[model samples]
Target chain A: MKDETDIQTPDEALEMAKKSRAAAADAGKKPLVYHLALPAIVGCLIASFALRDGLQLAVTAATMALLALVLWRVRKRGVWVGNLRGAVSYLLASLLIVLTLAAMFAIFWLKRTYGLDWPAAAIGAALFPVMVAMSLVWEKLRHRDLTGKMS
Target chain B: MTNPANGLEPLFNAPTRLQITAFLSGVAEAEFAVLRDMAGVSDSVLSKQLSALSDVGLVELRKSKLDGRQRTWAALTRKGRKSFAAHVAALQQLVQMAARAAE
Candidate 1:
């Protein structure tokens, strides 16, 4: 409640600074669903590989549609902490993409070589946890950036 | 060798304005109601403070309709972010100075 002109001591200034940091952190906070949605969508996309031909294409299309809808809802929330402007963010994104492709290839190889059943589904199930962890890391890094606390 | 106090901007001396800028610094943009809740300020108070920051080129405001309702969003300009960082650094410096003096 005190204005800057009213802050006469170090304690007052520190309090204001703390409040500012809290405000910044709060601005970046999102609903729990927001965090889980992306990983689930990616999981569906990966799982689609278990289907054949027409069904696979249909699943992929539906997954894309779901991804688009999630993105739209996030945008409508009026806050965007994931701006993807920094080098570290871009690096993380690229790494995820590469890892996803590698996982998909591994699934395909297993399916063709060993006659593994539901290889894509198995890989997708495994990937869900990894993607969730990465999503959490992404949120933490972005929040740090917003608070000017990134090291 | 520069004085940290010199980095502090007069506009952000107001706690409310500093809070607004700090919140905006963390995101691409925020809805007016979200900012109001975070800052714990009324709509009019928030509008006033936002206008002050906007007038000084520290913040940008946009009005749009979402779902058939009017809404306003606020974002910090590049200059605003620079200024806020400086203000925060200055505050930290003050706290450190006090701590050292106490020790």
Candidate 2:
């Protein structure tokens, strides 16, 4: 039998990557969706009300396409395919964008039903930046937590 | 590193080197000790593996002072990244062929 000190096959590299991906999760960049979600949501929401009926969806589609392009371009950065869990984490990250959109739509529904003004939209749109701020704050906290022990 | 386009990199066949490259491919950089821990190897073994990687220009190790203590970090170069991708593709191909053969 081959021992642990033996040379790893190419397949072994893949298997090892799949195995250690979770414990090493903190090493890679956060999923791309985390950075793009709020902007995409805010863009669609504003486009819906600010633009004319025909232009509303067109602008939203264009914005989404732009977002997709950007995401594709940056996809290779810090990409690590650890295992099924890592893959699922990325999948869930993208799915969170849909959830964010759903929340924005809920606000749109309120505006249409209750005759709320742009003030409501403004407040709703403001949440997107708030989310960004909170995530940034949390990221800093996590960074400090990670680095503090090391230094 | 061998030309990934040509074939799988035999260089990374060693378990320690494979583990190091695999982990570094995901992150921008990691402390040397972190990588050593990840590879589950001793100082000399990881140092030797890292030297091999560095010799082939697959990885770059840098030393700096952090909090008055010397710190070393390792990162995969662009060539390293391409090689890793190619090797992974080759591995996937082999797996598919094996599955098909078994079926």
Candidate 3:
């Protein structure tokens, strides 16, 4: 097996070493996805609580999954005590989306079963997917840069 | 055996040093704890390697204090960065040459 140590050159090796350090520091910053998605996540939790009987648990699971995904991303691509972190971010993110959908479903169930009005539920429902999709796209674009300092 | 491609080898060939360099390469500067974690090495081992790299003028170590605790940060000197860039280029060249030879 080819280990990183087997690679050659005094200078190139040094560059990789330095890049690893910068990568660590940059990884410390939370992804933009997390920041933007926070509001939608909060909305989901709120809606889930109001409609707990139907989809609350599922929504809650989705939120947990999303959080786990973000952390996974940090662990995988993000720097850990030097190269130990693997790439579990994608899986975690998927969990979050599922959680969000669950919450939306709960709201749907509530509107149908209860007398909840259309406008509020419609607005909340619309916001969740848009926010999640935007967050995903933003992270994909930002992470392409190795430094993780997009700006 | 040597790399037959460009007659050049990777610099900072050692594991510890490579970890250190990789960590430093991404940052403007880094403290001891930072590098320690990045390299996944003990204090003493990392310290020894840093000392050697510093001796070669490849790294610059500056000491300061954080909340009354002494702090040491490491950075690559200009010569060090240049050397690293050249080393990487050489390795790439070697890889390319080797590929061509195989073909």
Model 1, residue B67: C-alpha shift (Å): 2.1
Q: After TM-score superposition, what is the CA distance of residue A56 in candidate 1 from its true location, in Å? A: 3.2
Q: Which 10-residue window in model 2 chain A sums to the lowest lDDT? A: A76-85
lDDT of 1 by residue, B1-103 (tens): 4687897888887777877787787777888988888777888889999999999899999998877888898989999988887877787787778788899
For TM-score, the strongest prediction is 1
For model 3, the superposed segments whose C-alpha errors exceed 4 Å read: A1-22, A28-151, B1-11
Ranked by lDDT, the better of candidates 1 and 3 is 1
The global C-alpha lDDT for each of the candidates, from Candidate 1 onward, is 0.77, 0.62, 0.59
Runs of candidate 2 exceeding 4 Å displacement: A1-10, A27-151, B1-5
lDDT of 2 by residue, B36-61 (tens): 77778888788888999999999998
DockQ of candidate 1 is: 0.46
**What CA RMSD would you report for each candidate?**
3.9, 12.6, 11.7
TM-score of chain A of 3: 0.35
Please give the ranking of all candidate structures by TM-score, highest first, separated by commas: 1, 2, 3
What is the Å distance of residue B101 in model 1 from its true position?
4.9
TM-scores, all models, native as reference: 0.76, 0.52, 0.45
